[model samples]
Every structure is written in C-alpha cells, then in structure tokens.
Target: MIIGYVTNFNLNQLDFNIKLKIQSDKFISSNCRKQYVKYLLDFEFRKNFHCIGIPIIKDPPKDSFVIGHHFFNDQENRKIGSYIFSYCFEKRHYVNLPDFTFNTLLILSHPKSGMLHFKDRNKRILFIKPKPKYISLCTSREDICGPIFMKQKANIIKKIDIEVDDNCEIGDNCICKNKTLKESENDLKFIYFVPKNTN
Candidate 1:
C-alpha cells in the first residue's frame, strides 16, 4: 500500500519527492535489471533519491528482512505490486517486551474506564478499519489525531496476574528463523489468513 502510494505520489500527481528504502537479508535475484549483492540499490525520483540496502543480508539477525520475490522492471506500472512484509521498525513504538519479539503492536489501555485492562484487542490493534473518508485507513475509532481520547500510552511497572498470552504464528511467506513465540496472542485462532474470535 505504501509503496504503491509512494510511486503514484512521486511521479504523476504530486510535485515534491518521496524516497523509500527497503533493507533485506536474502540476495535479491535479478536477471536483466541487475540486483547488486552486498551493495546499495539506488532509485531516482525528481531531485530526490531512493535507496535499498543489504543490512540484514550481511549479518542475518533475528526478525530481520528477507527477499520475497524477484525484481520486475515495470516502467509504466512502477511500484504497483503486493508488498508482504514480515517485520517493520518504529523507534517510538518500541516496548521492552521480554518475551514478545516482533514489530507490530503497542499495548494501550482504555481511557474512560481507568482500569488497567485493555479493550477489544482485535479492533484497536489487529485490523485496520477506515472511516467515511478513505484517507485514514489505519486510523482507529479510539484515535483522534495523536491525542486519542479513548486510548493512552502506559508502561507496565508491575504486572499483576496478567498471564501473557503466547499464541504466535509464522506469516504465509515467512523466511526469518528467529521469530519469537511471544508475538502471538491468546485469542488468535485463524482459519487460513483470516482471524477468528470464537474463543
């Protein structure tokens, strides 16, 4: 979604520039366009520049990047493709989850109840639902810009009987070896890729 958005945003409609970088471990095999191993990839957009590098490929760490598919040189339909990512990083969203070891969640608490318990874990965190306007697809109902009224940031100074749910699963095309079991939740029962909340 973001890559396609960036492609369209970079070339056709907008004026400025949007650069993107994808770092992966596996060697991105290419026949014609030439994918450089142990080197940096460079893509030009207006005056701005975009680059992809081989950071994880050098050391190949736990929860690192992996090559998904071969390269396609599509000039007309640039950057229009299904992007399946296993790991992502946000320095701000980092929590010291001793057990959990993936990069996709931020444990938040209900604002009104003032109870330490969380609300529906799935709606606020798992799925992405958009409002009447289609721009903010990932925006939750509890979110109102940065200062959401229904949710707030908190740190677990002391965990009281909160039995950490350890229900984790590998992605459909997961290649990384050191995935953490703590990334799973207690209520995650999936029929194929679709999650079920029957529990």
Candidate 2:
C-alpha cells in the first residue's frame, strides 16, 4: 500500500511558536490521521511494529507532540526528500515543535539553499542551516536517474524495464523525421550495490 503524508504543524526549526500550531485540533484531525497511514508502503511493519519508548530531549516544549511512522521499500530506496519537512514534522512526528498562530505552512513549504557551519571549542559543533534564498528546480542527479532499488549490504538488483520510443522531440529545430525507422528505441537494465544497514 503506497502511503503519503503531510505534517499537521510546522516541524522545521525548533521554536516555541511552532509548537503551538502542532498541538492545534486542526492539525490532528481524524481525516488527516487516516490519510497519514494510507501512504505506508510497508505492510509487515505496519502490522507487527511496536514503539519501544519515547526519549525526553532537553528543552522540550510543554505542549509539544511527537509521532512516529514507518515505510517499506523492498525494491529500491525511492528519493523521499520531497517529504522531508512534512514527514519530519508531521508524518513521523519524529521531531518536537511548538504551536503558533502564524501560518507555519508558508515558512515550512518555502524552498531554501543547503549550507553548513561549524562552531565549537573542539570544532565538534556543526551548524547546518538552510539558506534564506530559494532555487526553482534544485533537484539532484539521482532524481534525474529516477528511483533506484533499495538493497541490503549485498542484495541482488531487480530488472527494471526502460523503454524509449519515437515520440522523442529533439529541439526547436529538430530534423530526424526522414528516417524510415521513424525513431530509435531501446531498453537498459542494470544493477548496483547497497550497504547492509541502509534500511
């Protein structure tokens, strides 16, 4: 069962205001709760998995909430960064956030740059903060390659069907229409290795 989810409240940066929004009734609706589980891809974990316990982190807001979720990918580890903010805050409730009156959605949904900084006596502290600027199509090469199969440390790769067709439209001044074959087509299937602890 393919599952998709959205955070009820903004789970980004840890702030007091953000925590309040998360505790709002609007964020935890029955309809939303049901939808949250619908996107779960793993069947076994959904049925057999149980929470061991919850840890108490420092400075946790008095009105904060945390939720945990699990997913499955026996075939491949599909890129799921698209749901990072939402999943981190809402779906999994893996992080703590404060409720606020402002529109947390806008801040959380906005795109930002990726950068990091280090500040500590032993240089052990790393400040990985999102840049204020936003880029339109900041996708990764892996995204272009599409989804690759997830595997164990030495798991076997599955055969994926790649079909190319004549429907290829070159550029604005393309001139490959004269060929009797009409177009070129092919299918390429390959395999790669994954670590044992990836899952």
Candidate 3:
C-alpha cells in the first residue's frame, strides 16, 4: 500500500541549487532513489521496501503531501538516527512518540551541512539540533534544540501522478546562495484523487 508523509521542512534550501520544482510523480523509497535526498530531510526506516517521502505541501491546490527518499550506507548506526524519530502511520500507533508539544519546533541552518532540522505542519521552524556527542534513545542533542520526527497523516488516497520538467537537484550546480528558477523551468504539475465523503 502507498503512504504519504512530510519530507523536508525547508523547501527553499533543500531545492537550493537543482530547483526541480517538487512534485509527487513517483514512489521514492529510502536509499533507493535520490541519494542526496537523505541529507535533505530525516525520515524513519523500514526493513522492507523503501519509502519516498513526498514534499508536505501545507495545502496543495487540490490535495497532495510529500513522499520521497534516498540512500544511506545501510549501516548498523542506522538505529542511531531512528531513535531520534520514528514514522507514525495510522496503523502503527505507538505511544512512545515524543510528547506532542509546542516549543519543540526550532530552526537550525544548512542541514545538508550538519545534524538535522525539525518543522511543524504549518511549515514553521521547529528544532535545530545536532548529532550528540554521547548519543542515546533520547539524546541531549535533541533535548536542547528539539527532536526531528516524521509524522504522517494518511487516508484512502492512494496514488498521486506527478510530472516535472526536469528531475535534478542543485547539488554542485548551485554554487551561490542567491539562486532562482525562471518561469519556464518552474513547471511542476500534480493530479490525484481523494476518496469522497462516505457518510
């Protein structure tokens, strides 16, 4: 079954250089596609097929959320990051989820440059913590800034068709901080169906 969840909180920076207008055209399972995307945002891990976190559009024109992912070394330390955050689908309703709070959300800088970033549904900057010197399940690193968690709100909506002009992220292409995409290059189209009210 297909699932939807938030990918990166920071839109501008994640797409900083390669500016391929974010659109949900396909399923991006973890460590399968877009290798660099692993550095862009944080998501939970699953042993089976990988998950592609499509960008979490607050409220897309119609309705769409992020679903994209990329590759990591698939190492033993994988649990280290997983401890910080876990994927919450409707099925796996685990109570261990960090206490849902307000101040937890803060913003750091240059995540691809460092530890991690945490953003809320409204796209507000949440926490900006780094990997801990002495890591644990609830490490001091996240305690100070705030932990980054990948929360998913799902429904019967299954597949979303995405079409982008070019599928490229500005890794080395974007050298400068002040980069912009022209109108012609900013073509991202998405079309999907949501189940109608069953009442």
**Candidate of highest lDDT:** 3
> lDDT by residue for model 1 over 85-135, one digit each (tens)?
222232211111121111111112211111111224333332222211100
Cα lDDT for residue 54, candidate 2:
17
Best-matching candidate per TM-score: 3
Pick by TM-score: 2 or 3, better one: 3
Pairs that clash in candidate 1: 25-57, 167-184
TM-scores across all candidates?
A: 0.16, 0.16, 0.17
List the candidate numbers ranked by lDDT, top first: 3, 2, 1
lDDT for each candidate structure: 0.21, 0.22, 0.23
lDDT of 3 at 194: 16
Question: Candidate 1 overall Cα lDDT vs. reference?
Answer: 0.21
> What would the per-residue lDDT of candidate 3 be over residues 136-175, giving only the tens digit for each residue?
1112111121222222223211122223224234443321
Error of 1 at 126 (Å): 12
